[model samples]
Target chain A: MVSAMICLLKMPCAVVCSKIAKRGGAAWISTLAYSLAVYAGAPDVDQIFSARWAAGIDDGRSQLFELGWRPEARWRFNDGGRLTGRLRLRVQTESGTRPGNIENDSFAPATRPQTIGETGELDLRELYYERPLDDWYLTIGKQQVVWGKADGLKVLDVVNPQSFREFILEDFEQSRIPLWTFNAERSIDDWLGGDWTLQLLWIPDQTYHALPKQNATYAFSSPRLAPQPPPGVSALIRSSEKPDRLFADSDAGMRLSGFVSGWDVSINYLYQYDNRPALHQRFISGATPLVEITPRYHRMHVLGGTFSHAIGDWVIRGELGYFSGRYFLSNASQAQDGVASSPELSVVIGLDWSGVEDMFISVQWFESWLSDYRQGFTRPERDNSLSLLTRRYFWNDTLQAELLWIANTHDNDGLLRPSLSYELEDNLEVRAGLDIFYGKRAGLFGQFDNNDRFYISLRYGL
Target chain B: MKIQQLFGMGVLLMLICEAVWSTPLPDADEIARRINARDEGVAVARSLTMRLTDRRGKTRTRETRAFRKYYGKEKRTVIFYLKPANVRNTAFLTWDYPQADKDDDQWLYLPAMRKVRRISASDRGDYFLGTDLTYEDIKLETRVSMNDYRRKTTGEDEVDGHHCYLLESIPVDEDTARELGYGRVEQCVDSEIWMVRRSRFWDIKGKPLKTSYFRDIRKVQGIWTQHRIEVENHKSGHRTLFLFRDVDYEHGVSDDLFTQNALRRGL
Candidate 1:
C-alpha cells in the first residue's frame, strides 16, 4: 500500500518534469532537485471532502446545501523554485422557501451548472511555477497575488478579480480568480539600504469578475439591464464587446516595497481595464419605446500604498488607493448614452492587539470618497465602514472561537460572523459558523439579510 | 633571637595566603559569554521532529528542516515545515543582531495565504505551534548575554553522572519578567562543555511551571549538541519532545535563504 501510494504521488511530478524537459529551457539539475523535494516534503496525497448545510433564520425552511472536494500538490526545487497545482469541485443545492419562484431568481443561471445531482464543473484553482534568480524572483502561469494587509477590505488588493457567486460568504482565498501573468521581483536592498524589493507584473489573460447569474442564489437586484425587445418593435441590436486578446490589451503593474524603522511599506501602480462592464444605452426612432444596451470594458489607473508598523504589543496597518477614470452607472433620471467616469479615493487603517493571553483583537476603519461628486452616479459621494475581529484560543490552541463584525457606517447596514473551529487531529478539523446580516434592503449587507444562515464544515487533510 | 625569627616566618606565611585568595573566580556574565561562544560555527543544518503530547495523552508530530548561517556579526536562521499536509511548505526566517537593544527581524510565510508576513518581536513569548517551547527558548541557545537577565551561580549539580554548574537567572525588572511569563529560571550547565543539560522555569507566583531536560549529548563537527530535548508543563499535563537528526555543520548555505522572498518560496 505504501509503495502504491508513493508511486501514485510520483506520477504527477514525473509527468510534469518530462513535459518541461521536452519543452526544453529547464535545467535537468533543477528538475531533479524539484522532484526530490516533492518526494521528501509532499504528502502522498492530500484530499479534503466537505459538506455544509445552512438555513435562513427568518424562514427555517429556506436552506442551502453544498458538497466540495479539493486536491492539491506542491513541489520545490533548489535555489528557491516551486510549483503548485490545485483542483476544486463543488456541488450546491438550494431550496427556495421565500415568496419568489426559483425560476424567476436572477442568480439561478449561475448556479445551474453546479446544481444538485449534476456533474459539477472542475476548477483549476492554482497552476503556477516560481523561480528565484540571483537577486530576482519570477513566477509565471495562473496564480493569485495578494497585495494588501488590511483586514476585510480591498484597498490595494485589486490584482485579481473576484467571484461573487456566493456573495461575501466565501473566503477570499477561494473567491479570488487567478490570472495568467508574468510576475518578477528584484531586491534593491544593497542600494536602498533597507530590505527593499521591486516587483513587476504583466497579465496577458484579461479575466473579468464572475458575477452571480440572474436568478441564482445570492444574486442582488441591480438597475443595469440588457433587455431583449419584443419582436414587433424595430430596435438596433448591440452585443457586449470584450477586449481582444493582444499585448495592448494586457494589464501592467509595478510595486516597490521595503522595511524601514520597524515599518513595512509598499507603493504600487496598476494600469488595467475594469473587470465589470459599463452599460451603454441607445434609443431607436420609433413610436414604441425601444432601447439597446451594450456592455463594454473601460480603462482605469490605480495608485496605492500600504504600511504596517509594530508599536509595543500592537500592530498598526493602513492602506490607501487613488483610482482615476473609474466608470459608474448613471442615475435613472439621466438620459446618458453611457456610464460616467469619476475619480475616487479609498483608505483603510487598522490595529491588531494581543495584550491578553490567548486572545487577539483587530479593528479597522475604511472610507471611500469620490473626488468630483454629481447627482447622476450610482454610489454616494462618500462612504464609511468599520470592521472588528476578535479571536480566542483554547485547549492548547487546538480550539479557536472568532467573532467578526463589519458595519457600513453610512448605510447603517452590517454583517456579523461568529465561528468556532476545533482541530480533531493533526490532519482533521471541524468548523461551524453563523452569518447574520442587518439593516436596509438596498444596502450591501442588508440585501443578504434574508440569506442569513448557519453552517458547519468538516475537513480532513492528508 | 630564635623567637624573633619564628614570628617573621608566620607573617610571611600569612602574606602568601592573602595573595592566593585575592584571585577572583569568573563572574556570571563571563560564564554566560563563554557558554555562548562554545558552539560557534560558520553554518549548520538539521532536520528535527517534534512530538507533542496533550493532557489527554493525544500526540501530534511535526517535522522541519532548519538552516542557520552567520554573516559578519549578524546571524540568520530559517526553518521550513516538511510534514503534515496542512502545514507543508510553511517557512519562518529570522535575523538576529549583535546589538542587544535591537529587536530581531522575523517573518513568516504561510502557504495558504501565499504571502510573507512580518511578525512582531513580542511574539517570542508565545508557545511555538502548541509545543512546550517558545520562540525565546529557541533563541536562548545563542543569545546568552545578560543584558536583560540577572544571573548568579547558585552552586553545583550533577546530571546523568556529569558535574554541572547550577545557575539562577531572573529578569532585570518585573515588567520584563511578566512579559517573558517567567519569574525565574534555573539552568544546569555542563561545566566542561558549557552546554545546558536541564532547566526549570517558575511562574510569576514563584511556583514551578515547567522543566526541560536535554538528553543524548553528542559531538557533531566539533560542537557539543543535545540530540534530544523534552519539556514538560507542570500546570498542564502536557509535554513535548524534540529530536534532532541529520545534523551537519560547516554546510555552505546561501545568504539568499534567509531573505523574506526565500521564505515565501519555501527554499
Candidate 2:
C-alpha cells in the first residue's frame, strides 16, 4: 500500500508540476495547485483538475479577460455506488462593468453564481450520487441532464436553464446551470422486438435563465429583446417574479427511447416553467404616461421527440418539440400585458458527414413556428435558422481547425466562429479564434456585432 | 503380355495417387473458413496502449480498456478511454453482425457532452482517431471478408521464420473497393496457426498505401493471440503501434455490458 501511494504521488506530481511550471504565474493555477495537494492527501479518491484563461483582442476598448479553475473528485464505494463533486473558481477582468442587483436570478440560492471579491465567483457545479440497483440506475443530486439531438440550438434540451452572459459563446457544459434532480433509468429487453429504455426526472430547483443585466458586456440592448420607451414616456421595471417553493414549483419529465432497424429514437415530455420570462406591462394614461413592466414566470408544457439514423458515412438526426402556454412580448396597441400567449412548434433536422478523412461536417436547419401568431410581436411568425459546422484535425490529431456559422433567415443576422487549437502536450492546449457577427441590430446575432473580436485561450488539465 | 499391361496400368494409378497425396494444401475458401473458425474464446477483456508517431517522430499515447463478448454469431465490443484527461471516461460500443450485408450499430458516449450519440459504422475506411489503422483494420483484425473480396492462394512465403501461405485478395466491385479504400491486399497466413502474420494494403488507386505487421503471436488461455501490431503508412510517413496487455478470457463479460446503458455508466 505504501509503495502504491508513492507511485500515485509521483505520477500526478510530474504531470501537474511540469504544466504549472511552464504556464508560470496565475492565481487560478495556484488554486489548482492547492487542490492537487488535497488530492494527493487522499488515496482513495480520484480527481480531475483543469485551468483555463481567455482574453479577447482589442476592439478599441478594454477587452474581455477571464480565468477559471475547475476541480472534480469522485469517490467509489464497495457497494457499486459513486459520489462526485465539482466546483469552479472563476475571475474576470476588463470585461466591462458588472451587472447589479440580479445575482439571485435563479430559484435556488445554491444554484446561483456566487460573487466574490468584486470580479471573482465560486460555483458549486455538480454534486451527485449514482448507484445501480437491480434493473434500474439511480442518480440523485445537483447535476445537469442533457436531452435532444440538436447542436448549438435548443429544441427539447430544456431540462436545465442557461446563462446568457456570453451570448452563447461558451460551451453548454459551462453555461448550463445544474439543478437538484432525481434521475432514474431502466432498460428493457426484447420489448416489441427492440431494445428500449425509460428515463425519468424530477427537478425541484426552479432555476430561470441568468440573462445578462443592462450595461454588461453581453447585455440585451436591442429593440427586439429590450424595447426602449418613447421619448415622452417613462418606464418603471420591477424585479422578476420567480417560483419560491421547492415541491410545489418542481419540474418533472419522462422519456422513452428505443432502437429499431438501425435507428435510435426517443419521445419525451416535460412540465416546467419557461426559462424565458414574459413581460406583464401596464400603461397609465395621463399628462405624463408611465409604462410599468414586470417580468413573470409561467408554466409551460413541452412534448418532443428525437431520432437519429446513420447511413454509410452520414448520420441524420431530427428533433421536434411542441410547446404550449408560452408567452411572447408584443407591441400591439390593444395588448393588456404587452404579451400574447402562443403555442409554438420547433423542429430541427441535421446531417453529419465524415466522408473526408480527418474531417467532419454538419449542417442543420432549425425552425420555430407560432401556431397563434400576433401582429407587432418581437419575433416573426416563423423563425428559420441554418447552421453549418466543419472541423478538421491535422498533425495526428494534435492540431484542429473548426468553423461554425449560424444564420437566421428572417433577420438575416448570423454569427461566424473560426477557431484553431493545438495540443502543446498531453493535457495542455492552446487555442485562438475570432467571433464575428453581422446584420441589423434587431437580429439575435446582430446585437453582438460590435462585440466581434479575436481571442486566445490556454487550457491545462490533469 | 496382358499381365505386363495390367501391371503398367497399376503403376500409373499409383503415380496419380502419389501426386494427389503430395498436394496437401487447402484452397483459399477452406483456409478462410479455418481462420474464421479459430477459437478466440467466448469473452475477452484487456487493456490497450496505442502509440501514434508522426513524420516528425512525435509520439502520442492513448490508453483504453476494452471488453468483448460473443453472443452466438454476433459479437459485441465496448472500449473505455482510460488516459488523457480530456477524453477520460469516454466509451464506445459496437454490435457487429455476422451477415456481410447488414450494417453494424455503434454508439459513442462523450463525457463532456453527457450524451450517447449514434455514429456510422459503414465508414470503415476512415482512420480511427487519427491512427494509421482504419476502422475496418481494427474491427475485423485478420478476418477476411468472403462477400466483398475475391481471394486466391498466390504462393508460399516465410514470415518471422515460420512457413506461411501467401493469399492475395481483391475487392469484387468498384463500390466495394472504394468503400474499403483498398484495391488489393496480400496476407501472409501462417501454415500451422491460421492467423495472418503480415499484411500489405494498396490504395483504391492502386498505389502502395500501408503495411501491417502482427507480432508477438502466442497462446493465451489456449487461444492464439497477437499481442502487438505495427502499421506503417507508405503514402504518409506515419506509423501506429498497438500493444495489448493483461488479456483475460476466462471471466466472461455479462450480456448487459454490451448495452448502450453500459456506455453511459462508464468504467
For residue A399, what is the lDDT in candidate 1? 88
Tens-digit lDDT track of model 2 for B48-112: 99888888787878889988888898888888887776677788888889987888888888887
Report clash pairs, candidate 1: A105-A215, A106-A214, A106-A215, A106-A216, A107-A214, A107-A215, A107-A216, A108-A215, A108-A216
Candidate 2 - chain A - TM: 0.87
Q: Which of the numbered candidates is closest to the native, going by highest lDDT?
A: 2
lDDT of 1 by residue, A57-165 (tens): 7777546666778876666656556777666767655633211212212111211122223424445566677887776788986778788888678887888877776
Misplaced by over 4 Å in model 2 are A1-62, A97-103, A190-193, A232-237, A282-292, B1-25
Which one is best on TM-score?
Answer: 2
Which residue pairs clash in candidate 2? Answer: none
Question: What are the models' TM-scores?
Answer: 0.84, 0.88
| Candidate 2 lDDT, A77-119, residue by residue in tens | 6788876767777777654533232335554664665566577
